[model samples]
Target: MIYTIHRTNQPPRYRGEWNDTVWQHAEIASIEKFHPQSSAFRPKTEVKALYDDTNVYIIFRVQDQFIKATYTTYQDPVYRDSCVEFFVMPMSPERGAAGYFNVEMNGLGMMLLYYIEDATRTTQGFEKFTKIPQERLRGMTIFHSIPAPMQEELTTPLEWIVEYNLPFSLFEAYLGELRPIAGTRWRGNFFKCGDDTSQPHWASWSPIGEALNFHQPDKFGLLQFA
Candidate 1:
């Protein structure tokens, strides 16, 4: 499964609008491959991506039920709530940079980012991982349909969106200056999860095998930049 990311003439304003002009030109990918561990309830989730000279724009729209979000602080465990994530490896392993960035955000747009070199599970965390500094994340802006600090779960069906733009400079800070993003090929996966929600579920754009893990870079799909 190769997702082709086209270049956008202008960056999208942080509005979380699914059909805005800046996003209409991009292709949409669905997160339909639910993990076996997930509940029977599967929410409809889709993503769109676009790139410009300086940043990459990504947005997720989820038609959800039993929505929940509580963590608001950066680097908090947003995956425990209704979340959407993007794990991207900008540089190929052939270049000796096997690390990838995991951008995890909840419905309220609170996010956690890490550059993971080694994904081996550890008693503490990944064997090799760096939590992205708050200062470096200042360049990114997020827009979410729902506000923050949601403790009560809304059982009614709802549609929500989380959108953000990640500066290329962020990736360069760890992997060194990346070659022109255009025509560059990357490996990545998109995921939707709600570990503590009433209807806990896990789904991905690329089918992750029987293992209920997202850190398997070997299972990532191709991300072709156009």
Candidate 2:
């Protein structure tokens, strides 16, 4: 599965609106596979990505049965709620996908991010996962179609969208400068999970296998430049 990103001269306003002309050209990655071969629900999820010289923009649209968000603070296990994630590794001429980054946001737009060097995830029996302080993410941008502080979970066949921007400079912190010209292949994946919702499920753009895991970088699909 290869996703060719749309290159845009004018970036979107980051308002969770997918009506921008640039987005019309984005290739969609559908999340249809349920993780852990033992599961049965498949919530509808669609994601699109675009990039400019300085930033990579992503948008997500989800059709879910039970949508709930309990955690509002940064890095507070947002994955337990209805969530969408974009994990990416900008290619480098020297080391292949040297390192990757995880940008996860919940239904209410709360997020958790990490620039990983070794794929040693907490699921792989590591202690706690390492993440940059939220203060450092001040430079990043996120926007949700819904207002936050969801006093209660919405279980009425929810449909929502989220849009965010990941500045190229953010990648420079873990892996030096990443300037991918045409034909550069970045290995990454898109994911949707609700570990604590009324009806929990995990889905991915590329199969993450029969086990409950989302840290499989090798399983990531190819993301090529337009």
Candidate 3:
């Protein structure tokens, strides 16, 4: 479903607390269905986002009894574990389009930031699609929770949150230039996947179908700057 991301003049603090006024007012999107559309066991997942001029602030609250994440290094295969992902494609009414960026973080908050030339997860400035250039985002400031490596897989009932302030400059670095004005829309999707977890599941805000591929940008929902 298309989501209108509320514009906030002042985004919420990067802390994990979700009590901020902006979060209270905006509608939270819940991702419940599985990728194949036939799988059962829906996990509790809630996401809220806000965008200002400089950054887009996002928060995710996930509750699951069989959560698992082991990858701690940046750019590692976090999708194999319990992961939350944000794929944003900035658009222009006249220019028509720019590239998209994928910011994926496991439950331990390890992130992999990469720019896609197309829907197939091909990245720029790196020979391998899994390897991202650390030199590009030299001075960009970002934040995430659970910075330390999580040793054990959380099997008990667990509720966790991961928040980030993704800089617009980072998006522009890979996407050329973006002019997000009121009512402008971006093609994107949010995802939670765990290929190697105790309970493997792939859930998304926008349905990804039986392909089980998150790189399908054609099925992405619109994120309007409102």
Per-residue lDDT tens digits of candidate 3, residues 4-50? Answer: 88888677766777777767756688887677642354678889988
lDDT per residue (tens digit) for residues 1-226 in model 2: 8889878878877777676777887888898888764236678899999888888889999987677777888877888888999999788877766767788898788988877767654665333345867766766777886676666678677778988888777787667778766777788999999887767888899888766888877898999987
Candidate 2 stretches greater than 4 Å from native: 36-40, 121-129
CA lDDT of every candidate: 0.91, 0.80, 0.75
Q: Output the TM-score of candidate 1.
A: 0.97
Residue-wise C-alpha lDDT for candidate 1, range 20-92, written one tens digit per residue: 9889999999999999999999999999999988898999999999999899899999999999999999974
Report RMSD (Å) for each prediction in the order shown: 1.3, 2.2, 3.0
- For model 1, what is the error of residue 49's alpha carbon versus the real structure, in angstroms, after optimal superposition? 0.4
Ranking by TM-score: 1, 2, 3
Which model scores highest in TM-score? Answer: 1
Between candidates 1 and 3, the one scoring higher on lDDT is: 1
Model 3: how far is 35 from its true place, Å?
Answer: 1.8
Candidate number that wins on TM-score, 1 or 2 = 1
Candidate 1 yields a Cα-based lDDT of 0.91
Least accurate 10 contiguous residues by lDDT in model 3: 121-130
